[model samples]
Target chain A: MSALLEVRDLTVRLRVGGSDREVITGTTLEIAEGEAMGLVGESGSGKSMTAKAIARLLPAGAGVEGSVHFAGTDVLALSGADLRRHRAKVAVVFQDPRAHINPVRRIEDFMTESLRTLEDVPRAQARTRAADALEEVGIDDPARRLRQFPHELSGGMLQRVMIATALLSRPLLLLADECTTALDVTTQAEVMAILDDLRRDRGLSMLFITHDLELAGAVCDRTSVMYAGQVVETSAADRLHADPLHPYSAALVQARPDVTSTAERLVAIPGRPVSAFEAPSGCRFAPRCPHALDSCRSTEQVLTGLDAGRVRCERAATLRGRLLDPTESPTESEETADA
Target chain B: MPDADGPVLSVSGLRKVFGTQVAVDDMSFDLAPGRSLAIVGESGSGKTTVARMVVGLERPTAGTIVACGRDRSRPARNAGERTRRGREVQIVFQDPYSSLDPRQSGAAAVDEVLRVHHDHDAATRRRIVGELADLVGLDSRQMSALPRALSGGQRQRVAIARALATEPKVLILDESVAALDVSIQAQVLNVLADIRDERGISYVLISHDLAVVRQLTEDVLVMQRGVVVERGRTTDVLDEPQHPYTQRLRASVPGPGWKPTRTLRRPA
Candidate 1:
């Protein structure tokens, strides 16, 4: 099946301190129709930058290269009416609802502003649609909620409103950038369920960007691990969780504290995450990878097709079955038996 | 009756009222020396309020706090008393970005704490600062860098270093690693474990993440709307939660092979 959104060789450069620095270097990704693709990375990995680039939301003094094709149209080449039309089909929900939603405006105004101004819908009809959207997100008494301001509602309720507003545009693709990160676990679960249900009901495609690997694996059909502004690995979610090929991916999976496992120590990556400017000439993750070789640090690696998906590590083929299984570490089972 | 050698910290019927709203209500717990206890709850659940009360940031309307075998329910009346309390218990806040002064370097921040708490000479202060930095894995270069120059994790390390300057008996971590990246969080968690091992300091960890609570804490207290809904060993409470709220919280954590489900109805 053809992809609903395809980003190819995308590079984003920002003018920082009078010099242009590459923030996202040759990152390519694709999301098939009705599929949820997770982009997992640490800070400065360019996951959010890549999503913003695809959405044409980069700030001033930012330069872009490569093409983003959506529904057989080049998103980069669009302008004026075409750009507006493209934006309508692709909506983004940010991490913090309080930051994105205008505090002074009523819920109805925030929800239906785009529809009324862009689509030229009547205010009365827009209000009706707004109420329906709120109800769809599981908020009861939609009419009462529409009359209230942003601060009148709780964080979880406001996030629901934000998701409801995004759905009002009827976008085929949604970009959720840590939409649930600021919420409590129970609220996060509720929001994820709502998003998942919405995607299944509407056949929506999503690009979920977060620092949470386990959350990504739970909600996304496929997962991509990014390091220093590059896609290091991509695979089916279950396979990626079971056996990650790239060393960085494996380390990330091991680094997390599991709820079920009783491992004595979490395996933390040795060094901090590197930015694009600080990235090495060869593999970006080589400096911190435990299994790195002399040759791995000298030559740049390209993404190679594997059994389930693609990986950028040169030794991924040989590293298979040697990497640590995130959930089934022997120490955990032994500790469990002791308990 | 409290055991003579039972716990390093103990609280009985702690309550805090902010105007008409009760931020923390009838909360009680105990922390044995070198033991870690996690208070897990959502926002407005009074977990933070309880932490604040323990650290003396907020005076409780009711209940008593006994730390190091001294009563701390009433506000300290003098600077000496406050200093004594500071040396007994210290808290690390959530936001690392705002916890430290923007103008002060990491080394300077730790030095200030040393200067205030200790009457050591300048040479001794400098050496202690370096040792504290090394304990939290901060390099010499990062020691002189300002907060803005450091990453979230590095800033948190500085915060941890500063908190340890007094060598307090009990360290209150209020969502300490929540602001950090996953990898950085793991590194900090490891550092926390090392500190507990070497110094034998008890911990009062306040967090909303169940996975993190499981990683670092030995016991768990589940709070809901300022009430203690559940309390037990971390593994037991997490594995077989008795309270509905606790069960919901344990089930909400997303993991491999887990599927998102609707929110459970709150038990009345």
Candidate 2:
């Protein structure tokens, strides 16, 4: 099966204080046709950059070096009108709906503009199509919603509008960047349901970026864990949850709050993710990893397995017990347990 | 419902209004010392408004807030006297990045509190900020860096450290961990738990995530449009939610086991 979108050795740089700073470091992945891939990491781990790069929407200060191929076309090679049209192939849904939807514009305009570039329908037809899209996404009173301002609608409704707009273009690929994080859980679940239904029906491939592991597990078929802008591991969501191959991925699993688990206290990763500018020497997560050893500090690893989507972490296999390291506790770590 | 141990903070029939819109109405809950009470609500349900009122940011149109046996304590009004109330209840905001003044460095920001609130001189203030930063897992080197330089987790940790500067009795976290990454969310939640155990500080944790609330808080309060819809043990509310709103909230948590292909019927 051919991939809907394949990204190769993507590296993005930006000028910071007279020196170039690398945002994405040799990041690579692919989204299969009609598949969902979850890109997850802490902030500044280059998740959003990868999405922006795919959309060809990097800001003016950014410099890029990589190849993103979609539908038999080298995305980077597209020129003039071709590039703009190619850019529309993969639509992006941002973290906050307010950020993407114009606060000044009405719902009617947002829906119309989304389709204007992608389709050549009559104005009356477009309005009817917009109302239909809104209804399809489960918006109540679709006609009333069209005239309302962005602020007048709930965050969930605004997001529905964003999704409705994305679907208006009928793109094969969609990029949702923490799009549900800002919403309440009830609304998030509703939005998730809509996305799941839409994907199956429309055969939409998604590159879903979030810092939430639970959400990734629930919504994604496969997940790629990133740390310091590198894809640490990518595997089936359930497999990753059960047996994470990378040290960072393992820690994230233990940290997720599960309703089934009766653990007395929530486990916390001891240290913060490494600074993006000063990437960790060997493994990006080595400094904070409980399984970190002398061998991990000197040897850098890369993606080694295509069969099961495994990582090159030298300590991953042998570091099993220490992955959670039940005994090891940072000094102030226990003070909160009793609370 | 009042208990034998007595509540450090108690609210009853709390109501708030913005013109014709009732942001919060008839909210009631009790916070015991060293205990954490999670307030879970949907957006526009008045969870933050309740917190703001408890912290005295907004005056309550009705109801009473009794703190440490005083029927109602004076709210934080001006910069000069705000520190006095800061010792009673300190609030941790959602966005740590914007919460701090951009002009001041991390250390300088923490030190400012010490200088103004703690009545410490420049030298002492700097030292105190170093201790605070270290307490929240931040290094002294980060003291000179601006808020923009730190990661989301680090910035939020800085916010936590600043909240602890006055040694507040009740720490009110309003979507404190919501903006953080999942891994960082657990880390910060741990920090909050540690603070409560070490200092016997009570917490008024406000969130919309039921799983997170169940993990950290023992007691829970479910709010709907400012009204206390349900109140009980966190496990009780999560495991067997009695209120319709509470049940819906619990069902709403997205996880691998549950298929994200069903939507609950809209509230009638």
Candidate 3:
């Protein structure tokens, strides 16, 4: 089957002062039909930028290079009615629902406005479809909820309403950019489940962007680890977590706290996360990686295909089998030896 | 400062109401010296309100707060008494960006705390500020830099250092590490654990993240809708939760092999 979305050699440059600064540098990704791809990275890593570029939501004065093809159509070249249709087909749900939703507007008005105005659906039909979407997301009393304002609902409920609105358009591609990050853990789990179920039922392709590696691993079929505005590793979510090849990916996995296991100290990744502007000439993670060599500092590494995945590291071959899974518990003797 | 009979911090029947809404209802907990307690709850669960009451930011509707062997059920009568109360327990709030003054350097922020609590010479204040900076893992460069110049983790370090400047018996971390990234959060958590071990200070942690609670605290109190649904040793409560709310909270945390499920079944 053909890919639903293909982004190749995409670079985003913003007008900073007099010179242009690159925010995303040569990022290539593809989402197969009905496939969910997860993008995991820290702040300023271009995860959101990638999503925005695909959706053509970049801020004014930003320059976008390369191509974004959605279902064999060039998304960047679309204009007028074509662009509008493309946008409707690709729905995005951001982190904060309150920010996206108007405070004074009723839920029904917000949900049905896009369908009625853009798609030329009548008011009554729009309302009926909106109610069905809300019911699909497990929200009861859709009529009463439709009359309520954003402030009347809790954060979780507001997020559910947002998801319902996204589904109202029956989007072929869903861009969830940290949509669950602002929610509580239980609510996050519930929302994730709804998204998972909806994707399966509708055969929707998803671009799941988040700062959480574990969450991405759980929900996405494949995961891409981004660092300094570039994808450093790409692998099956389960394989990536079980044994990450890139040193940066290994460090990030080790940095997260595990609720089931008790470790005396978390293995912190050294040095602060760098932005694209401050990224080094060579490997972006060389400064913080423990196993960085002289070549890593001066030589830029491109993504190389491995047995089951791709990694952008100079020493991935040599370091294979030596990297231990961070989630696994070390033996008592090993723990004591380290201590 | 060790009290064999009494806890370092204690609360009894704590309650807070905002006009018609009950923010916190009949909440109670205690923290012994050199121990830490975690209050886990979702937003609007009254965990933050409890912290605010303990820090004197909010006057409790009813209940008593005993900190460092003194009852602070009511607001302090005078500035001197307020300062005395402040010297006993200090709080670090969630957002490091807004909690800190944008113009003040980290060194200056810590120095101001020393000025209020300690009547020391300029040289002594400078020495103490440097020591506090070092304790929180802030380098000299970062200490001299303003809050805006530092990253979220660095700003949080300055905030922690300022809180420790008072030499309080108890520290209240109200979602202190929530705003940080995972890597930076780990670094800050380690700094907090080191402080607890070296200084023997008690801690009251308010957070929604169960993993952080499991890592940093010994005792856990799970709150839902302003009520304490469960309380016990952290491992016991997390491993085998008796309350339905606690079970849902424990299961909600995503880990290896975790799959999202339905929302918690509403209690009858």
Candidate 4:
């Protein structure tokens, strides 16, 4: 299957403090038609920046290199009406819905404004469509909900409203950037289910970005791990969870506190995570990686193909299975036995 | 002195009414010395209200809060009494930045807390501040930098250090590690566990993340709509939750082989 969205050798340089800093360096990824790709990374890893670059939402004084191709169109080169139309084909749902929506506006006006302004739909027809969209997101009494203000709705409800509004344009790709991270766990599950169903029902492609590895794995078919503005590994979500090829991916998996069982102490990554601009020369993750070699720090890391995906580490072959080594701990075994 | 075997903190028949709406209704729990208890609930479940009442941020409509064998149900009589109560319990909020001053460095913040609570000499205050910074894993450089110069995790460590400056017996962690990244959260959790073991201090963790609750707390209280639906040992409550709300909450956490299924019933 051909890719619906292709980002090739994308580099973004942001002008910070009177100097340009490379925020995203040589990052590349693709999303096929109707495929959900998870972009997993820590803060400053450039996952969100990559999304903004693809959506042509970069800030002023930002310089870009490389191409973003969407449905046979150069997204970076789109201008005038073409850019506006391209924006309509791609929608983004942010982490906090409250920050994005106007507080003074009613749900009716907020939901129907895009249709009336962009497509020149009649007010009554747009209101009816907005109500129908609200119902589709499982909100009951859509007419009543549409009459209420943003503050009148709960966080989960407002997030659903945001999703409903995003679908108003019938976009082909949804950039769900931590849309559910701010919600409660049960609400997150419900919202995630709604998003998954919508994607499948509408044959919509998605670029799901989150700091949660397990959440992305559960919802996305493919997962790509980003480190310091570079694509470190991409594989089937379950494969990445069960057997991650990259060392950083393995450490992240080991670092999280497990719900099913308890350990004496989580295997904490020694150093703090660094942004793309602050990353070291050869490998961004080498400083924190436990299995780093002398050569790993001296040479430039490149993505090497393995099966259906790609990994950046040169010693991924030798470090397989050993990356997630269980340290000797009597507390872990005792807890497991108790469970 | 309080009995060694008694609970460090205890509350009974706690209730809070905001005008006509009852935010928390008839809640009760105990925190034994050196033990950790978690109040698990979603937004609007009144878990935060319960914490607020216990910490004297909100006056309860009807209840009794006793910490270290002293009743603090009513407002403190004077500034000295309030300071004594503060020494019994300290809280760490979710957003560390909001709790910290932007202009204050980590060491300066901790020093301010020490100065307010004790009449230590300047040299003693500095020494104590250094100890607090080291306890929270902040180096001398990070301790000297302002809040803006630190990362989110580093700022949170500074908050933890400030909270510990009072040498309180009970720490109320209200979603303390929720704002941090997973790796940073792990480091913080380890730090907390070590502190608990070393100081024999009690913890009351208010959180919605079940995984974090399981890792940090010994006892768990599952709340919904201002009522406690389930309460037991953390392992027993989480591993074998009887209440439907608790079961749904446990199932909601995504992990290996987990699949999200939509439920039509709205929680709030």
Candidate lDDT values, in order: 0.90, 0.80, 0.90, 0.90
Q: Model 1: runs farther than 4 Å from truth?
A: A325-339, B1-4, B264-268
Could you tell me the TM-score of chain B in model 4? 0.97
Which whole-number lDDT from 0 to 100 does residue A155 have in model 4? 97
In angstroms, the error of model 3 at B121 is 1.4
Question: Model 4, retained fraction of real contacts?
Answer: 0.69
- Say what the RMSD of model 3 is: 3.5
Model 3 reproduced share of reference interface contacts: 0.66
In model 4, which runs have C-alpha deviations exceeding 4 angstroms? A327-339, B265-268
Give native contacts recovered, as a fraction, per prediction: 0.68, 0.63, 0.66, 0.69
lDDT of 2: 0.80
Candidate 2, DockQ score (0 to 1): 0.50
State how far residue A290 of model 2 sits from its true place (Å). Answer: 2.0
For candidate 1, write residues A231-276 as lDDT tens digits: 9999998788888888888888888898876668889998899878
lDDT of 4 by residue, B188-242 (tens): 9999998899889999999998989999999999999999999999999989999
Residues A87-122 of candidate 4 have per-residue lDDT tens digits of 888899999999999999999999999899999999
- Please list all clashing residue pairs in model 4, or write none if there are none: none
TM-score of chain B of 3: 0.96
